[model samples]
Structures are given as structure tokens and as C-alpha cells.
Target: MTILLSQEIDRTSYEPAYAQLVNILQASMATGVFKPGAQLPSEAQLCEHYKVSPMTVRRVINILLDRGLVTTAQGRGTFVKGVDIGEAVFHLSGLKEQIESTDRAQVQLLEARIVEAPERVARKLELSPVDWTIFVRRLLLQDGTPVSYHRAYLIYDPRRPIVEGELEVTSLEGLIHGNGQTDLQSGCLSIEAVTLKEEEAAILSMGQGDPAFLIDHTFYDFQDRPVSWGWFIWRADRLKLSATIGNRPPQDQQSAMKDSRRWTGEDHE
Candidate 1:
């Protein structure tokens, strides 16, 4: 596709020229003017097109590269690395349950295991360094098309038979809460826009640097104690998040309780 330069360059502005250039490039990507793998105009070409210095154009290219929106080869030209618009649909449920409810996707469990939690995982789950965790990893498919990757960490408890059973048959969180061991209260969650790694992209059937929604969440018990922590990656093009916000708290706080198994983060709240 040919790169078009329509707007006249504004000589005086608070924003730097490179910043403006980045914005234009990003807008082009969003509008599909420049599709993924499409080579961008050379720095010299951009300099002439935007009436900017070569240094300025180079800086703009650097910004895109840092954000994982573009790649450059020494002899080859720069290319678009797919655009991520931060679209994600999150719910107070595990990925399996969420996808199943959609009735559009069939989830496939790729792997599952019990392992020692890393320091970050240990801190999030409030488990001791020596404590173990049941790590559930899986791939989700929509009509047999891969869409997401999930990794869940639950505190190790040998007594819970739920861990030993098939996860497909039982909800891990439901089983944990049903045991009367923990009463889920509330949770904290966070979401951010990210570029998928090569392996992650492969799993999602997308290219590296494709847009993805990185969701990090933590579940808490009735006493406001952390129960589980998880990370999920969803394809941006396939989902969008929606929520109803109210200034006042719910009429019945007890009845407004959400699922205990789902991760809650500030982004979702």
C-alpha cells in the first residue's frame, strides 16, 4: 500500500515533531492504512513527506519500535507489527467457564501441573516460599480456532480432591469455596495493553507483536485474604470489555458478591 501524506506540517506546536509523527503512524495503523507486515516509508521519504528532519523521522520510528508496533532490519525496511487497541472482555469467572458460557468456543486443556510458585507468584497468593501451587495452564478455542492462553495458580492443598480430579468436570474455585475453608469477599485486578511474545502469539495463532490484552488478577476471601492469582491473554480483535458503573454501592453488599474463583483487578473493577 502507498503511504500518503495529506496534512500540512505544523511548524509551531507544543508536541515534538517526532511525537506528532508517531501519532500519525499510529492513526494510520488503526485505520488499516498500513497493515501488519507492510513496510513503512523510509526515513528519508518520511522526512520529505512530513517536511521534517531525518533525525526527527528516525526518532519517531524508534518510538514505534519500542512500543512493539514496528520492526526494522539493517538492509530491509521497517514494517508494521500489528496494532493492539486494548480490547478485552473480562468477567468474574475463569477462562473455561467464560468461554463455555459464550457457547462459541470449545476449550482444550493443553497442560496442567503442580509446581513451586515463583517469588512473584508466591507474593501474590500470599504463600510461603517453600509452599507449592497447582498451576493450571490451558489453551482456549472458539469454534476450534485458538483464541487465548491462561495460567492459574492456586495454593497447594493436598487434602483437596478437586485438584486430583479432572478440571473440566469441576470448577476449581467452586470446589475451594464449597469446602467451607475460605469465604470469598472481594478481589483486585489490573489490565494492560501488550504485545504478544512469539510463543504466546503461536499459541493464539497470531503473529508476534500482535495486539493482546494482558489481564492480571487476584481473588480474595471473606476476610480480605488473597486466595488465588492468575494471568490471562486474550486476542484484542475478538473481545471487548463492558461494565456498568454506579456512584453508590449496591443496596445489598452481601448479595452483590461476585464469583470467588475469578480474579479481580483494578482494571476490571
Candidate 2:
């Protein structure tokens, strides 16, 4: 508790007492004064040391809980939470941008041709099985090591520029953000753990039946119509998703909402 007492709540500042206390505790944690899993001072101790009421200390604890900075047990006191890397947010653009940001990243076009829409893909894209669709496959690599295999089925539209640029990795951004053909209104993504099949294994240069991640994506137009559908198979060790949590300004909240809408296809009027 000596470390916690080194920083006192500012009494004269315009900031609320609770806010100042929170900053003190947060700063202590940042400096490793309060290591992960360390128990915080008891409510009585905090109240006595800070000269604050029990309600204020409780409120501070609640705020810490909301920020995911601490956890509480029924019988035990609050403790600092250990950072868990697996607790991360998944974002489509984030993943794409991360791969491209790598200096040695490369994208190789494997196949691009018209093919009859598969029943599942047709249903997902709201197309008939008899309709023709553009089938595109690409391999993503980093430093010459295969990382992901991309397979997509797009609605056949010769007039759209997306079809022409679909063969290039740069155009993948157009597919997500939209090309002149149709602006991307929204989209949804699903990911699951899967074992690599023979073909998938060969493409990723991994052993057959190796663990991998399968991400399915579906994009829609402003009309709420499905425009494109595809999946990306990634090596298990190649990707890790992360996101910011806790308080944000109104503008930042709005921006996060827009990103959510783009990825989840949630229509917000």
C-alpha cells in the first residue's frame, strides 16, 4: 500500500476526486507499482488513506472494473487483471492493413475465372446456383513464407471495375471499401478454427490437418443486398487480433461505430 499512497488525490484541482484517484491508481499500475494480480488496498484502507468516503472508493473500484483494469471476487478484494493477448478484437481492415504493412509481404494471384456459383455461396450472395460468378484465389505471403490463402466469389458484372482489378492485391482494398461499381455499405465476418485440407495445406505450405483460421466475409451494397462473399484461410500462428477498450470521446465512439458497421454489416439508420 506504500506505493499506492505515494500519489495522493489532488484536492484543489478542478478534476473530480474520484477521477484523480483513478489516475493515481492507473499511474501506479503503469509504473509496475501494482503488478498484475496484486490486490488493491481494502476499501477501509483506501478511505482512510485518501480521506474519501466509502461510496467514493466503491465508485472508483467500479470504474476500474469497467475499464477491465481490475477484477473482484465475492469474498476477496479487487485485484489487478493480467493482460490476455487472446482477448482481442477482430477487424477485417486491421488484418489486411497489418499484413500489407509488413515490408516483405506479397500477394500472388492464383486463379481468376468465371465459374458456376456454389450453392452455399449463391445463397450467401443471394444469387441463383445457375448464375455465373467470378472466382478468384490469391495467396498472401510474408518474407516468402505463406500466411493466408484467399478465395472469393463475386457477382459477375463486366461493367464494374472491381472485376478488372480483382486479380491484383491492391484491388482487395477496393473490394472492401468499394469500387466505382458499388460503394460498400456494410459487411459481416465470421471466423472459426479449422484443420487445413490437402489443397489448403499445399497452398499454405503447412502440413495437412494443421490448425488454421477460416474467416468468411460477406459485403453488401446500400440497398442491403449482398454484393460479394469470400473466405480467407490463415495459418494459426500468423495472426493475432487486438482492439482498444474503455472510455472514448464521442467522435472516437462514432468512428468505432462506423468501423463496426463496415465489418458486421449492421445497418444503423
Candidate 3:
């Protein structure tokens, strides 16, 4: 879209010219006229386009740079960096525990019940149609602010009665370990950005078009048998994710510490 920068700037207004310029550019960005990594016009081009002085344009660009909305190269000119919400860190834990760690949120257990596994779930858990599972639904809050809705399912074994009760006190992984199931090992997770559906938005206390992070996690035992599966839908505005990718855990363990420190700095920054 061709934004008429000059027309959008109100000359009679009390706002500074640079501030007005920033506002114009921000509006253009919000409307999708400018995109991430898209090159912005040079200072001279902006000066000419807006009918403003070169210094005024530079000042506006500087503001955007500080906000991490754009980055400038020595010779290539300015480019949009998009809005960096900063680093997001996520931990695997029960809904209540995770929210409590933030100290800014609360959690409400919306529903907790045991039910027969659906066909898909039964297949994933490698269970018969008669097998049952515990379904727990919860809402997460931040500083008393509602943020996300989550649902988790664990295959129920009659032999593991302790596992059922521990769900209320510990994370799935923790409960598994407490049950003397230390043989449990790692599994894969998939994450994606999505827009909330109408029903999801109502339960999450968000608008229908609001952004969300959908995470699908599957857990397995040392024998590589799927043990549990969980689905979480988190508000994009409230949560952040952090992950570490590397070679398998080191054998020396000492080297792992050094590697962890290095990656932590890079990831957090």
C-alpha cells in the first residue's frame, strides 16, 4: 500500500514532527503495509516522501531502532525487525504449578474426570477400547488475569491408582517418577502459532481473533511406548517459550555444564 506520509502527519498538532512521523510508520506497520525484514525507505527517501527535514526522519528512525521495531545496516539501509516480544521461557509442569511460578497468575481447575479413551487417543496410547483415561481441564491466570486453557490426558492403569491422585499435586513427569516408573524417558513436542476458535476464546477469556500458541506433547517410556499425551493452548500475549537444541546430554557431565551456560546466555539474550 502506498501510504501518503505527508497527509497523515498533522502539522497543526502539538506533537513533535518526529513523533508524528513515528506514528505514521507504526500505523503503516499495523495495517500490514510494512512487513518483517522489509526494507524501509532511506532517510533521504523518507525526507522527500514526508516533506520533512532529514533530521526529523532520522529521529523517527532512531525511535524505531530503540524499540527493536527496525534495524539499520551501514550500507544496506533500514529494515523492519518486527516487534520482538523479548525472550519467552516455558517449563513443563502442572497448570497450577506453572502459573504459581510466574507469581503473576492463578489457575482454576475447570474440569477433572475419568472417561473412556476416544479411538484416536486409544490408538496413541496403544490401549484397547475398554481402557480409560483421566482428562483434566484447566485455565491459567497471570496476576489474576486469565491467559490460557489447557487439557491433558493420561492413560489410566488400574495398577497405578497413585498416579491418578498425584495429578492434583505434581506434573505428569513427576508423578511417573514417583510411581517408581523411572524407566520413563523423552518424547517429542510440536508447537505452532494459531488463532483461537470461538469456543476456545470464550473459555480463554479472549477475542476470537486473538493469537495463541498451541503445543502438543507426547510422552513415552524407556521401551518407547507412548504413555501420556497433552494439549495446551496458551495466549500469545502472556506466554513465552524457550528451548535448547544440542547433541545428546554429555557423558562427562562437566562439559555439559559449560555448554549449558553458553547456550543459556545466547538463548536468554
Best by TM-score: 2
TM-score of each: 0.47, 0.56, 0.47
lDDT of 3 at 266: 59
What overall lDDT goes with each candidate model? Answer: 0.68, 0.75, 0.69
| Shift in Å, residue 154, candidate 2 | 0.9
Off by over 4 Å in 1: 1-103, 159-183, 242-269
Of candidates 2 and 1, the better by lDDT: 2
- Residue 108's lDDT in candidate 3: 77
> How big is the positional error of residue 218 in model 2, measured in Å on the Cα after superposition?
1.1
lDDT of 1 by residue, 1-269 (tens): 34675665666988777777888887777667777888888888888889988888888999888766788998889988753545233353434444644466565667767889889899887778788887777676777788778777876667544333324222333432344343455556788999999989999999999888887867765556566677778887665553322111225533444443345566655
Off by over 4 Å in 3: 1-102, 165-184, 241-269
Q: After superposition, how far is residue 132 of candidate 1 from its true place, in Å?
A: 0.5
Off by over 4 Å in 2: 1-22, 25-98, 158-170, 173-182, 241-269
RMSD of each: 18.3, 12.3, 18.8
Against the correct fold, how does model 3 do in TM-score? 0.47
Candidate 2 weakest ten by summed lDDT: 245-254
Q: How many clashes does each candidate structure show, in the order listed?
A: 6, 1, 5
Candidate 3, residues 46-119, lDDT tens digits: the string is 88887899888988999877755688999888887654445223454344344556456556788878999988
Model 3 weakest lDDT span, ten residues long? 241-250
User: Tens digits of per-residue lDDT for model 2 on 149-171?
Assistant: 99888887665555444334224
